[model samples]
Target: MAVFSLMLVVFSLTTGEFVVSGILPDLAAGLGVPLSAAGLLTTAYAAGMIVGGPVVTLLTARVSRKPLIIGLVATSVLANAASAIAPGYAVLLVSRMLAGLVVATFFAVAIATAASTARPGKQASTVGKVVLGLNLGIVLGAPLGTFVGQHLGWRATFWSVAAAAALALLTVLRFVPDRPSATTGPVAGELRVFADRRVQLAIALTAVGNTGVLTVFTYLAPLLTEVGGFPPGAVPVLLLGYGAGAVLGNAVGGRLADRALLPSLAGLLATLVVVLGLAWLGGGHPVATVVSTVLLGALAFAIVPGMQTRVITAAGAAPTLAVAVNASGYQLAAAFAGWLGGQVVDSGAGLRAIYPVAAALTVAGLGIALYSLRRDRRESSAQGSLPGGRSRTS
Candidate 1:
């Protein structure tokens, strides 16, 4: 039941964060804004996630984790309902931004909640279950929104999201136990964990890697409809294929990370460069575009679990705060990518241009990962040469 609660939170957050892609056109039509302007909705929402994560974490420092999570999930329901009934685009955008705030809090608390409840030695798997919800959201939620919007109008998609959030709220309330109060130290002390060099590197990689993914995804609709010449109705199918690949990549990445940490991280980033480059090159060919989309999803998301574990390991003392910051890093990357993608599109480079730009970012991230890997090896070699040659005697 506790795991189920975590999954529900994951599903709600995933759907709320991503449903925008499927309904972007409808939103533009209803809001009287150009698609480029309407893309601000995603950017605004991600910005909210970036700001809200730390604020919520700090404010709730003395609160029990379970009740706080339930409240956050309930807020998701209300925001979605507000979005569904919004009379104009401004209201809908604000509502979605609030929904983003709710998502940040829910995810941060869910990870904390999962860690608190996990059996010994199963922490990684517990974290994975929560993440599976996020991946499932990417895999399943957008398609659901697109289908509902196509048939019943865009408002119906929000209505369904509201309903799902309500269900998640109930599951969390019924199953997850009340958490103990968090550490009572000043929040600055909590934040000091991020000062570690390796922690900084891990967050940098997470930020850049996610930027690489969203730079392409933020423009996926335009590429499919305008560049690839796909019918509008086929959008969901392509996204679904991408989602399927994401799930596969996530599962495989998790296992690989468990077995070999830094190697897996470097390998995933290298794969992203190849996959993103292929997708960029294939943008003009329809069959090749579809193939690229699936590969794009796989290569991009494959880093999530591994990158997350890397941060937690590096920030050993304050894993909860570290994980929350990582979520913020992901949102920051998405917001930047969306803004950058929009600039490229509005500048006459066209939507396909975003892919090459994204590919370049992936390559840059791989370079950072390589530097961090070398640093790790050098430190290990230095440690091996320490006095007494690994003897325990003082």
Candidate 2:
């Protein structure tokens, strides 16, 4: 029940973050801004996340988990409500940023809480369940919000998000308990996780992997319409397919992480390379494009659970700060990937080129994962040779 509540909170928070992409057209038209200016709303939110994750996590490092989560959910409610009622583009932008701040803090804490609450050895699986909410937001919330915006108004989408956040806040208040801190270490000690080579590699893997996925995802609508020959109206249905794939991938990845972390991570990254390559090559065929898109979504998300588990385990006592930093890396990479995709489109390279670009990023991530895996093996061998004959890497 507690895990389910946390998932709801994350779902509501992530939905508020991603729903903007699906409704950008309506939002721009309603606010009397150009599409490019409206796109800045996403950029502002990412900026807030990049800044908020560490700051909020560090400030609340000593606080109990339950109240901290509740406070973040409350902030989300106010932010989305402000977004729904904002008088101008500027106000809406600020509201979006506030919403972003809530997401960064909320996810970091919520994920750690979920992992801590799980039965022994099921940390990654529990974290995966919580992350399923984020995937559902992308799968269901964005399209639903888009549908609502198209039929009603852009502001209605924000209102719906506010309502979801309110419901999530209630769930957290009702079900989540005030647990002890995940760490007894001070802020300085928590921040030292960055010094670990494995942690650094895991963070890099997340950033690069996310960049690969978002680069293609940020331009999925155009890719489908122009390259796949799908009408604009069909986008929601296609996004649904992608989201379904993501949900499946999240579940599978979590189970695999619990059993074989490194192999699963490597396999997922390699799968992304193949998926994106196929997406680029087969993009001209509608059926092929749809299949590739769904596969791409699955392979891309399948890497997340293993990555998150790897980071938390690697960080040892400082999982909260480490996870927050990882979240920040994801947001920063997303901001960069969005810009990179725009540049590809603007430079006459066309949407098809974006897939290859994404593939290259995944290849980079795969390289990092392999390096980390090899290092782990060497450390295990060394630990096995020690006097006690116990492997420290294990």
Cα lDDT, model 1, residue 252: 75
Error of 1 at 192 (Å): 1.2
Residue range 1-394, candidate 1, lDDT tens digits = 8878788778877887787877889889877899988788877778778878777777776677777787788888898899899998789889988988756666766776776677764555566677888888877876787789988998999999899888878887788888775657776687788779999998898888678788888788788888888999998789888888887777777677767777888988888877777777777799998998888777666777778777777777666666777899887787788789989989998887887788788888888788888998887777778885563333
TM-score of each: 0.86, 0.95
lDDT of 2 by residue, 99-195 (tens): 8886777887888888888888898889999999989888878778878888989999999999998998888888997887655667667777799
TM-score of 1: 0.86
TM-score of 2: 0.95
> By lDDT, who's the top model here?
2
Give residue 229's lDDT in candidate 2 (0 to 100).
Answer: 95
| Candidate 2 C-alpha error for residue 201, in Å | 0.9
